[model samples]
Target: MKNPVLVALFCLMQTLILAQSPTPSKPRILISTDIGGTDPDDNQSMTHLLMNSDLFQFEGLVSSPSYGEGNKKEILRMIDIYEKDLPKLNKHNKKLAKPDFLRSICKQGRKGNAPFSGYTTATEGSDWIIKCAKKQSEHPLWILDWGGLEDIAQALHDAPEIQHKIRIYWIGGPNKKWSANSYAYIAENFPNLFFIEVNSSYYGFFSNNTEPDTINTSDYYNRVIQGGGHLGMDFKNYYDGEIKMGDSPSLFYMMDGNPEKPERESWGGSFEKITYSPRTIYNQTTTLKDTVAFCSIIEIHLKGPKIEIPSDSVCFWMEIPYGKTIQKWPGYHLGNGDYAIRYIPKKAENLHYRFTSKIAEINGLEGDIVVSNLWPGKKHSTDYPLGNHWYSDKSDINLYDEKIQGGKTVLKWRNVILDDWAKRWKWLK
Candidate 1:
């Protein structure tokens, strides 16, 4: 014989406790980053992740620098700092992953972007991705891509079966500029892969457009993160301690909300389903009339005299306006003297290019291409139909920011997200 009032109170308490508790099972995550690369913000993001390591089942930390001098050594450097901070982090949560285990998972991916064909060869990091995706688990692996997609592209190229078992949240934009070839390869081949391409949307994580003064980029690290711990102290080495973890939104997206529904509002910026992604092809050197969208993949096909060279390497060189420097990309020989090169325009400008090969007929072949300001969206007709992919909808008025284009979706949650993180920073103190 139990009292009805007491039983009702007990039920209410249980409901509140359940609502406050984190998900019983941790989400499996594998982070592929270009740490210690051109962008030092990765250091900041890594520090943030280690501080909150308990929230995820971290399976891998891969160094995947597409450009610049970044490698697994940088990841190990961060782990070294984490090792010192582990005592403090463990005080708050003993579930924090061990430094030795994290070091074991640290792998080096490709040193540069993929060739015109997308994937070149598999690396330790790419192999690890395939291995983790194949592991027996009820939940899919969430790959947080903070760098180029070269490794992921290579892994998928090697093991297509894992496409359905893994999800990717890539911090694109500039990274897309670096890994355009691999991006095109994946978009065209693995159309069914569950991916969230956060191009400009991730900018919201650091946007100061409409944020509280306390957590503004210039002040938050000093106020909330500076004295937090060893990791916090080391965070000042990059960007002079200003918080510009543009890649942190991928982490925030999984922190407090349902990652299964990306369209729904979350601390991470909301994304939309886009059937088509921008892409274009040219049979010859393009003119202004044959303008292509910025950041979109453009493939150029050219014909040369039917002469086979003993060597397999062919080069595509594009002349830049600045200092009249030439940047080289790999060109593929498509049998019968046909050659092709895939290029991604990083800006709205005209580009001049030439091909160089051992075959004299293809050597010094020059052409011009016109790039437009048009970006990928409904307004752009030149796009590839991706069967199912999620990306930041640049057309969405609600998510638009005058400063960052499509970063408002994540910008709107700045205060709430930072406040939550600020509370966690206290644990290190």
Candidate 2:
């Protein structure tokens, strides 16, 4: 016979269940990316993944490179952006900027000078991917590939043990009639997997004011730091000659159709339809399959105070001449910036609340970074005490300081960052 109190507790539990109050499920993810791939959307994907690690248990992040000559250096820069930039953010603002993708946050990470700090030693990315897949006792591990299929193809070819252990969700390949120029560059097939072919080229996120290989605006930086605006060019700033795009071109997807529709499926990181093309192979047509479900960019709506990076705040700035070069490919160019962001990866099971919303929006993989103004604390509109809230143009001080003007952040351009923060009076910090 149950005690009267126990019976009462059981009744309460049943009532709660009947009311649809159930716990949420956790998503485990493995991310692979071509960081220096030149398409800016890859950067967005990295940041979104890191910001939303709470909703996903990120297994690993493999930074791969294409066979292209200019691509190698860009690859290294991508790794640095996600790996080395952590210390700088903390030093300047006393806040830790987490990884955009993820590694082992709770595990004992290796220490080094730069990108080698906190990550798995997947020297051979494909082999490493296979090894990780075969050893996973955990079920339903999600693999997100935001780059070339070379590594995955290699991993599959090498290790047949894990052919069915993972469910790959990627943003790649030309699934329709028009194939990518690199169609014949790969040679591995896995039918057990479901692909999310991303029409990344159709994405109009990257802005190109000029081809300044070194000096460029920080669209990625502003997205994580500033808030509220469109993706390509913040409409509020575009009319005044201020552009924020960096060049992920718009030939990836045909947005006329719904991404969930069948025909909408196409290539990864491009806009063109998935079709057999005679462009690359011996001047003859071929069946080039990308993924199962292909779609374009998931436009995220970010709303916050549009702050300005004042020149007077030069004390809160830092930079190096050759900022975004590659590690493996020293010749490539990921971007013009010198700094990258990094953090120790902890299982999403731990930081569930702080980053769940941001992660859920981007499918916990790669797309749109949702930055919240409420990170550690709030900041005043007139001044930033090194907290979360942004300093909008609507702030107390005039966003322009005629005394020190330069860089992409300028008042005349109606853009941010034109002011010289390293002035004699400012006394560089």
Candidate 3:
């Protein structure tokens, strides 16, 4: 006979461990930001990063500038604030990385964008990257480039062997424009590097299409972050108490779920495959919500082999763009079995439009009807690659040419509400 009480206690302990260990093993991350310069957005991004520091085993915070300004001291200043706030942060989650630990990882990278060739002498930051990548770890080192690629370029140039050990997520758009020369160089040479250029998708976090109550970065400061605590005060000081951390999506992708599965939806946004250049270009996948933010009209085109179906019952209802009334559009059969419907989004609030049929099922002759945003497609007036606006639209193209340096990648920003605010203010409650 077994001791009943002891068996019960052991079972309870196992359950507790499982509950506490809900978060997967932490990912290795190294943040390369250009704060204290042209834009103060990086300050907000860094604050968000520190608040979620428990999610990643931070490797380094390098000051890698593209143009106007970048200083390692600014990063240290934020870390000092984080040091003071650690006690409060620890109250919510005791496993947060210590301020001194983050301090030791902070280093300065390249001062500005590299020359057109993209190779300059390696610096302290580049060397640090090489060292971190070489260190034995099961997970790949995720380098979040909040600024230029000069330091990254330099790292790859010096140690070409470590390309597989690193995965780069570049917040490129305007940043790409600044680092055109270096970006071109990387694209031309390192065709096998694993990289994701975050262009328009990050803009979704601060888009005007969503409601202010949704707690996007646009109103997150006023609603949740402002009066929280030490972390709150530091965040306020960054951009005059505004929430414009466009770079937080990079961290978001790593936080909520497995960052490796970018194809599935999450708080950060979803991604889809693109034509593989030297680096695999993963563009941010768009949803119905992202339709209105980037375009004035949303179009749907469906095509399939000519089939027999109940046409009388099929109808679509969409919000009259920016209005309350719901309008329905009748599906028109275009000569063959092809079907088409066009509707402008009614509201800037959310995506709530769909096509419905009264029939239970339909017999198809050939294949599934392709549903896509036809308006964003290339017109007769456009070139092979199409216009740059489509980079953020529903139909986006992946590009890697040195001559065409306009669109890197466009992401659809999500109006996600996370618990960072609730945890920071938990003590008060």
Top-TM-score candidate index: 1
Candidate maximizing lDDT:
1
Return the TM-score for each candidate structure.
0.87, 0.38, 0.65
C-alpha lDDT score of every prediction, in listed order? 0.81, 0.31, 0.61
**What is the alpha-carbon lDDT of model 1 when measured against the actual structure?**
0.81
lDDT tens readout by residue for model 2, 1-429: 379999999999899888886554455555565553444455544433332234454566666544222233443344455454444334443332354433332111111111211122334566657666776464555566555455555455456557567655444332211112111222113433433333222221222433434233444334333332122122223323233322111111111123223223232121222222111111111122211112111111222222343311111111112225422211111122111121111101111111112223211221112222111112222211211111111111222122111112222232212222111112111
Report the backbone clash tally of model 1. Answer: 0
> TM-score of predicted model 2?
0.38
Candidate 1 wrong stretches, greater than 4 Å: 1-23, 208-214, 310-312, 322-328, 346-374, 378-383
lDDT of 3 by residue, 1-429 (tens): 299999999999999999988565688999988898889899988877887777788999999987777899999999888887777677778987888888899999989766435667989999999999999988899998899888898998999888889887777755764565466567556766666666556665555444444545445667777666777777777667766677887887777677666555655655554332211111222253332321122334455455565442233222222255644344433435555443322112345444443322212211111222222222321112211111121233342111121112212224333454455555422
**Can you write out model 1's per-residue Cα lDDT over 1-429, one digit (the tens) per residue?**
199999999999999999999766888999999998889999988988987888999989999999889899999999999899788777778988899999999999999988767889999999999999999999999999999999999999999999999999998877887897799889989988899987777777786675445257788888898787788889888998898988899899889677888888888778788787777767777766677766678777877766564323354454334455556667766667777777777656787766666667667777777766535633445566776655654556555666455677878778887787788788888
> Relative to the unseen true structure, what is the C-alpha lDDT of residue 32 in candidate 3, on a scale of 0 to 100?
89
Error of model 2, residue 375, in angstroms: 42
